[model samples]
Target: MTATKIAIVGVGKIARDQHIPSITRNGAFELSATVSRHSGVDGVENFATIEELLAGRPDVGAVALCMPPQARFDAAWTAIKAGRHVLLEKPPGATVAEVEALIAAARDEGVALFATWHSRYAASVPAAKAWLAKRQVQSARITWKEDVRRWHPGQEWIWQPGGLGVFDPGINALSILTEILPQPVRVTAAELQFPDGRDAPIAAQLQFAGASGETVSADFDWRQTGPQTWNIEIETNDGQLKLSSGGAEMTIDGKVMMQEADSEYDGIYARFAQLVAETSIDVDLAPLVHVADAFMLGRRIVVDAFEM
Candidate 1:
């Protein structure tokens, strides 16, 4: 069988670190081309813009957009119009509304569209979800704190409007939360702290209410200093369940449950390959919608200025 012809747009850090490597390692998809203003892969064809790439390379069957959330919609639209299946990196677009538009467009055009949340594919995450599904939930708390200077380095788009500062990482936790919860949860209140010089919030405290009347709290901060932490704890009738190291490991009470090494990006590529073969679309926007709601409805606070 012929491999699925795939091209990548916005060949920046994420595309290089995750998508490109996964695509190259996976057998089902062919890395046909790439579009970037300042970067290109070795030997693969390169174009200055996605429009130029689509116009010049009609054989490209799918396009993976690894751009900042603010610029994702236009690139996705262009690719869809060019009759290429589209795979969007997390937090799909500038707004949940724009993702809705993309869904409509992809359906009308009869091409697959996938909004990938890499974190949801963490090894222990599926086990946690299965465990939760069989038990009764009482309450939950998520504490995700990271050293932004170390993780982001000089990434400037993370601090801009629609860039999703802390929420960029926080959304990963939410994707897992929404997936494991037996019932749906809604944000009841949120407090966002914006850096003095930035348009986006650097940290957020979110309170959520589940359908079973369980209260959940999440604290997301990007200003953590040393010894970063990313943990989610849930109390159920059976016992306490916890996922630490960004869902790489699981535990209960004080006992080690299951330790899983990270391979979320690989899982994303595998899923995308399956979707391409089935000619199916799998785009879920609940996490993005919760983010938009937080942005639209949450109160904002000004915090210390953050550099880089």
Candidate 2:
């Protein structure tokens, strides 16, 4: 089978670190080109803008957008209209409305639209989902904290209006939560802590209610300086389920059930390949909706200024 020619827009840290490598390893995809004004992958053609890439490389049938959420809509719209399948990075768009619009456009164009939640592709996520399906959830707690300097480094867009702040990482936990739980959940309340000069919050605490009245709480903070924490503990009628190491490790009743290396991007690319082959849309807005609800219902708290 001829590999699908694909281009990656926004060759930033994520594109370089995860997307590029995943695409290279996947037999179904060919890293045809990239769109980045600053840097490009070795041996691949680079365009300064998405428009140039679209116009120059019509052979590239798919485009994976790794840009910030604020700038994602326009590129996604352009690609969908150009008859190219689109794979969006997490958060999909700056607003839920934009992603909704993209869905319509992709339908009209008959191109696959995949809003990827990489965390949902973690090794043990599927197992956790299966385990939860058989049990009744009593409660869930998400503690996701990491140092901004360590993870994001000098990225300033995260503190901007559309960057999503702590929800950037927090949404990963939410994605797993929404995926594994059998019932739907709604955000009941939230508290947002914005640094003195930043437009987005550095920390957040969110409360959610499951359809069966199960309580879920999430604590997200970017101010953590030491070892980062990304864990989700769920209590069920039978026992407790804990997913640590960003869902790469799973434990039941404090006993290790499953653990694996990080291959989330590989799984994402593999799924994208299937979507592209079938020309299907796999955009799940559940996690994004939860983040939006947190922002809308959260009480604002001004905190100390954060510096890199």
Q: Judging by lDDT against the true structure, name the best candidate.
A: 2
On a 0 to 100 scale, what is the lDDT of residue 308 in model 2? Answer: 74
Model 2: per-residue Cα lDDT over 1-308, one tens digit each: 99999999998889989998899899999999999899998899999999999999989999999999999999999999999999999989999999999999999999999999999999999999999999999999999999988888899999999999999999999999999999988999999999999999999999999778799999999989888899999999999999999999999999999999999999999999999999999999999999999999999999989887
Residue-level error in angstroms, candidate 1, position 152: 2.0
**C-alpha TM-scores of all predictions:** 0.97, 0.99
* RMSD each, Å: 1.1, 0.7
lDDT of 1: 0.90
Clash totals in order: 0, 0
**Candidate 2 global lDDT:** 0.95
lDDT of the candidates, in the order given: 0.90, 0.95
| Segments in model 1 whose C-alpha atoms lie over 4 Å from true places | none
